[model samples]
Target: MTDPRQLAFAHRRSADQDRLQPAHHPVVIVGAGPVGLAAALGFAARGQASTVIDRKASLSDGNRAICWSKRTLEIMDRLGAAEALLDKGVTWRTGKVFLDDRLIYTFDLLPEAGHRMPAFVNLQQFLFEHYAIEAAKRTGLVDLRWQEDVTGIEPTTDGALLSITTPVGSYRILADWVIAADGARSTLRRLMGLGFEGRVFADQFLICDIHIKMDRPVERWFWFDPPFNRGRSALLHRQAGDVWRLDFQVGSEADRDAEVKPENVAKRVRAMLGEDIDFTFEWISLYRFQSRRLKRFRHGRVLFAGDAAHQMSPFGARGGNSGVQDADNLVWKLDLVLRDQAPERLLDSYDAERIPAADENLLNTTRSTDFIAPKSMASRILRDGVLALAASEPFARRLVNSGRLSVAATYDGSPLNTPDGFTAGDCPTTRPGAAALDAPLSDGWLLAALDRGFTSAWFCAEGISADALARMEAASARTTLPVKPLIVSDATACTRYGAASTPACFLFRPDGYIAARWRSIPPDAIAAALARATGR
Candidate 1:
């Protein structure tokens, strides 16, 4: 059997390469990684086409980002890539924290039920990219060009001109919009003379992927000071294909080359899993955590997503998950802009919303790093004391920070979000700018019912009134934007949205985020909210 990671995509010359004049594309994406492919699929779902260019001819080489959050899975499901991921990925919802040899506390990521996706799935980055690529190909809208390097970029007032170089020759293409998902050392960002503004920690970590069969449950296990590597933090997670990801914090002074040696790594593994256990090395690497992001995600017609826009410590599994969400947030807005359905200024909201999300991730990851690897003796003492107390004390458990974990970012103060018309005391989770919570409906899941456009969810226990139905019909007719009406009669969903008694309505953006809500369906409120949401 051939190794899946070794599979390479064949590069073929595109017709654009032979065009006498520069061919213009509506959207051109640099990098065919997860984010870029996702952007392609997202635009395709919106009936838009995009040309994706990547220097690489294959998927990711190693088991790079292995943790996929539920929010990410939800977004992937919309893009038509979640089924394969869920089938092969290890589903995990619990994590254990330890202090030396003693287990401090174990936490459940998802305490509630009724969600279609699990809390997190552990799958290799290569597999994630492969599934996305397969989905994009199925759409027949993404023009993926492999081994095509974006050598130069000239920013125009309305778009960009990208100079492409391949093995055969070079060609120039005009893109009405450019998406740069090239990654941390982004060539496009450098060409534009942009740089990230944030902190890079001093500590280094050694990551080793080992293939072994064990009876251990699929869960995240983190240790503060284990016997395997005394005075350092360690993390272990089970991935698909009988592989386990192990992360060991090797202080800044440790020699990178020495730590990566198979013998040295094996010694640490033996210490952790006992000398009798057997394992084979699949991949080994050394990395330093950085909580940094570009000052702005949008640079005129050129937009950045994923590592090109932001980077964070891998502790919380926020990097890839946040990157996919960036695509989800951006593609719909861009699609509307392309179709002339919304003002160009609507794209600016991407910056307003995602920048704050990036900041939140940076803040949380920085805190996690600080707690895991204390910079000073004072901080170390405090962390140790907290860890010691966490075993029995609930208060100390709250203070423990193995990693805060990834969650969807809510656009709390976004200009697109309308002020809440009514108090949602019972369900604060469905507030304006919040991601719509998923719940089981009579027929299917709530998210599946939302289905690819703006949605007006009317929650009425007593059933929608004739006047409210007419108001909703009037609102839909008033706007050119697609706003599908969803009548929520499910008791569980009604309670989840805090509309069990009185009638309530919520205007959800195309990205499944609440734009506004009301106690009653106002005659002109949905139209006005749609106008604001699209930057009219």
Candidate 2:
């Protein structure tokens, strides 16, 4: 005989799922955060359908992230949302660090000819989410279902099944693939039994968005001292116009309940002003820095991006930037799989490449955090010494500012990224050893061959040969690059971007960066690069 208790428990479990005939799709993204939205837009960019589900009842109301890196801005530019963000956000080229009212370090992002974009852009996270949501809506490919709570996840041979409970009813969604960008406490990650391992900073921090009545230029200012609070630090960042993001170190020994109080937060901000800042506090919250990353970003059909994959301290503003990069790495593979352009082997590169980038950023962020908020006397002394050196030396300042770094995904051993005639140390730029990260990508394969007047942003050099003409024709039939085989005959233009003499070929990726450049364009290499970038 079956026990009534067991039967009831099973029924309750099924009821929690509240599914209605399991919906099916090519891909399902859990969470409508910036990363999930970026993934959705990626699907649209590749002409695929994705269903994004989020538990949030409404959009983010607070200032979560106010700093955007150059790479992220470029991505938004491609997605057709940068216009709105740029119009509202402030621009800053320099970041200054002050130790007890004395300038200790000043770093400038606008360097002399190295990168395609600057180190950072100051904007609120709400504006970021607002624009991403609007851009995703225009795509007409994403089915964003908010107020939908995921209760269970079940994987199948074809894909995985998601059981979600909405306010209206329950439903099941079958997805060819699933991405988890559901923040630190990700339900999808937990359901998959994935682990996030790292250290949580012992110090507590108070973050507040205040409308201070002051006339300060659009620049990021950081103060490291107890002048405002004993043994603590403060950061003031401009978000759009009057709204500013201010973070005050609440001390390790401070009571959490007292620190989170709005009155106490105002008191701290006022203290920083000495007399009175006369600021209206918008929102106040307490948080701590952590150095944690997931062991694996992928688990069969379920993939992780953004905070789901890892979480680092916001010292260098690495979290959202890394999350956007995660989307960039993933979207291409998903598009390829959807179009059947490449084998599933291509998807393997996502974890291999992105995990390393995440780990690298993790280390840099932790070091910066430790340097700023040292716990021990010895560590503090060492940090002060380094800060002093950075204040005086331009090289040291550049190194310190390099932590707010951005990069493109370069899968060294991935089958997609070929090992052609391009030598290992043959980097064409000065981007601090991470060549691919700093380099810009084109729409598709770029063949830079100087024939008479070889010219094209992506591909250059075409000759009188029938085969070369045929190769251009073949390229036109497959990729999205405007000039598949443009015939450039301008000598002056050839030397501008720094290319070899005539008859050289350079294949470009969809993001407009040179992927494979050689002495001459090989037919097979051209076809492979096109296939990799376009997924068709």
**Highest lDDT, which number?**
1
Predicted candidate 2 versus true structure: per-residue lDDT over 106-188, tens digit per residue: 76766544344556677777667777887898989987777788899987776898888876668787888999889888999
Compared with the true structure, model 2 gives a TM-score of 0.83
Query: Judged by TM-score, which candidate is best?
Result: 1
**Alpha-carbon runs more than 4 Å astray in model 2:** 1-20, 112-118, 388-415, 428-483, 486-497, 500-504, 511-514, 528-536
Whole-model Cα lDDT of every candidate shown, in order: 0.90, 0.68
Q: What is the alpha-carbon lDDT of model 1 when measured against the actual structure?
A: 0.90
In candidate 2, what residue range of length 10 has the lowest lDDT sum?
3-12
TM-score of each: 0.98, 0.83
With a 3 Å backbone cut-off (N, CA, C), the pairs that clash in candidate 1 are none
Task: Indicate the TM-score of model 1.
Answer: 0.98
Per-residue lDDT of 536 in model 2? 37
